[model samples]
Target: MRAQRDAPVDSMGAEKCMDQDASPEVHRFQVLVSLMLSSQTKDQVTHAAMTKLRSHGLTVENILDTSDEVLGQLIYPVGFWKKKVGYIKKTCEILKKSYDCDIPPSVQEICKLPGVGPKMAHLCMDIGWRKLTGIGVDTHVHRISNRLGWTGRNTKTPEETRVALESWMPEKIWSETNLLLVGFGQQICLPVRPRCAECLNSALCPYGRNPANRSPKKGSPSKIPTKNGS
Candidate 1:
């Protein structure tokens, strides 16, 4: 799968979704901000939110200086904007106090920040610090991993999926796994009517191979016979 060179881009991935040309400090800050704004938010919307924040000087000191109302307005339309405002502000305060306004390189330290979780911490570590700490699991990663039989069907959370995947997956691919699966999920193994026919892994995917697992097409019959002509 890694050798396939024609993979589609992940529009929602932190690495691809945010500005990549900034200095290390600015890039790290943008990555963290993007991850914070990504929860329950679309990639395009998150990108727009980051762009808006950039216009207002996206830095720890600048964010700390901005009013809560203005910050919330800038990150408007993201899930729980008001709550995120508090998280972002508190995180910036901690960064200023503890890390000299620079994003910490350690996953444990990054996770100590407000609103930053394992997923965000891992992603930041990989994208911002170029350190492969763990597989950054999100909803898409969780769902697609299960569908690909990389994890058990009962794997219920991103954290669980992360554990399952890391148990068997080589450490070398950890950094790129999230983006690859997210792009695959978005383009092929979708939550609704996935483009199974176009998927290279469809032959091995239980969900893709089993017609009964597929969602019924609009205005079409629900049941589909098995390959054995049942």
Candidate 2:
């Protein structure tokens, strides 16, 4: 189903969500690292972990050579840091062995690596490798898409939403969709309250300016009993 585009594209819409300036090679490694750190973690947590990983060395060779325990220690504060450290290390080793110490250029190849799911693969392909072959559906994209009436129904999982959007979203938006919605979700269309009155997409959004307005009514206010003697 098409996301209802009720309003004209904003005058400043093209200026939003600028593509990162990093090279393709750098993007790929960064994507892999970010995806690994992002699982069940907040963006702030992932940023901290990636910052530490950078200090330790970010290349595949460096990651492959590093100890799992050391990696885990550096990536702390990310959810399930200990286990993810092991997974990332194992993934690095696989990359080194299978791809000649280089992160593969193809989404298909990247998907074969340990801990690389479709979401991770799509992210790497878009931002990391610059392939722009697919769309990356994260929590923000999935939630905002449905709220924007792009998905036609409330989807419980990112994968389901991905398949649904991929079928209808034009190929031109394959790469930039996630980034746009991410910035939008973070700044305007928040999970709560949402500041809808000030939102640029309010006119086009099916969920409209205030999701709270649609919530089930509270019935009637309860009155408290008062003592007769005062």
Q: Rate the local accuracy (lDDT) of all candidates.
A: 0.80, 0.66
Which candidate gets the maximum lDDT versus the true structure? 1
Candidate 1, lDDT over the whole model: 0.80
lDDT of 2 by residue, 61-115 (tens): 7777788778878888888888787777777777777766557778788877776
Give a tens-digit lDDT track for model 1, residues 134-165.
Answer: 99999989988888888865598999999999
Which stretches of model 2 miss by more than 4 angstroms? 1-27, 209-211, 214-230
Worst ten in a row by lDDT for model 1: 220-229
- Distance from true position, residue 55, model 2, in Å? 1.9
Model 2, residue 146: what's the lDDT?
84
Q: What TM-score does prediction 1 earn?
A: 0.85
**144, model 2: CA deviation in Å?**
0.8
